[model samples]
Target: VGVERTFPVHTPVIDEIKIITRGDVRRAKLYYLRELRGKKAKIKEKRDIRPGAKAAPAAKAAPAAPSEA
Candidate 1:
């Protein structure tokens, strides 16, 4: 896992912080997030939401076949 990573989540300066939904990460390395969008986003709720917060409802997931990395 020490593969020199630069996550955009680091050092952020934003007004609103948001967790669209909790993701059911099956794999530690989610290469899947790269090939999804719009109605195709699919992540399972696997955590307790913070106080006064609600996990966003997911739109219809696009029926996309898993792509090769």
Candidate 2:
């Protein structure tokens, strides 16, 4: 998770495996899974620390002015 690797999944020709999901891992590895299982194997759910991260801001919305006859 936190650690970066060079030869872990190195490819010389082209392709290898397909990643299904990219987890928001807190630690370098999920080594705790060896002993823990079921409920204990679960990691704490991570939340967005960024403000207004749910959606992107509207495209610079401006106040419309009333037209005169």
Candidate 3:
């Protein structure tokens, strides 16, 4: 048994995200992530940066409205 968690990653500039596998190698990190012994061994795909994609509003988010009594 192991602990598993999922979190939201807010990357606004993610317009046309495409995942492409460089190669089907046994190594996970293409360096040594494959030499591990366990079910946590897997070659994850790399996320390539999209061209002409605009990043989300560079400005910080506005504050929420104040509550009224």
Candidate 4:
């Protein structure tokens, strides 16, 4: 996050300033993530959206059945 650069308004900088992520953020800022690390740095997952959208269940698969003794 230690990025520093400058761009003139006359240039085509729309793509650079645009919001690439369309997340439904409940909070206005995520500056706290900078202070966290690794898994702790992860933010709450948001359901993906599209024309035919579907929200995947957040569950882990059960372990396979043990073989017969």
Candidate 5:
């Protein structure tokens, strides 16, 4: 049997996010094996940030040419 549960996690980069954890019921105990691993991988990828790094600036649009009547 399988069970699913929702957990709220707070992080600096993501603020707060709800993660659904799944596990298998064995011997009346829930064993969460894959859910934790997957969550860790996802959070690692998202939280990969360098300190003192700046984001690239967006390009500005060119001014439209004056319409000649």
Candidate 6:
């Protein structure tokens, strides 16, 4: 009985490396933007008097009855 193992190999190709680097940079930028947005949201919540609370609806006045001529 014999055990066989297979290992994946990557070629030292310049184009492939450049493509992989671009993908890494794009992912990093997306992650940074997401984190920044989350921090801004937290800051905004802190500034709010009631976080996650809904604003009270404005009271609407009923129309006055027309005056008889």
Full-model lDDT for every candidate: 0.62, 0.63, 0.53, 0.60, 0.45, 0.38
Candidate 4 pairs with clashing backbones = none
Candidate order (lDDT): 2, 1, 4, 3, 5, 6
Q: Which sections of candidate 1 miss by over 4 Å?
A: 1-22, 48-69
Ranking by TM-score: 2, 4, 1, 3, 5, 6
Q: Count the backbone clashes (under 3 Å) in each candidate.
A: 2, 0, 0, 0, 0, 0
Q: Write the per-residue lDDT of candidate 4 for residues 1-69, one digit (tens) a residue.
A: 556355785686455665444644567987776678787766665666564343333233446689998
TM-score of every candidate: 0.32, 0.39, 0.24, 0.38, 0.16, 0.16
lDDT of 5 by residue, 1-69 (tens): 456665545545556555454333334533445456544423212332575333432223456689999
Query: At residue 33, what lDDT does model 6 achieve?
Result: 40
Residue 8 lDDT in candidate 6? 46
How many clashing residue pairs, candidate 5? 0
Best by TM-score: 2
Better of 4 and 5 by lDDT: 4
Candidate 6 per-residue C-alpha lDDT over 1-69 given as tens digits, one digit per residue, 9 for 90 to 100: 334454445644423422211121323334344334444423212233575333442223456689999
Per-residue lDDT of 66 in model 1: 93
Error of 3 at 44 (Å): 15
Find the number of clashing residue pairs for candidate 2.
0
lDDT of 2 by residue, 1-69 (tens): 344344655766557777544556677977676676578766665666687654544533555789999
Whose lDDT is higher: candidate 2's or candidate 5's? 2
User: Which residue runs of candidate 4 sit more than 4 Å off their true CA positions?
Assistant: 1-11, 14-25, 49-51, 54-69
Off by over 4 Å in 5: 1-10, 25-69
Q: Compared to the true structure, candidate 1 yields what TM-score?
A: 0.32
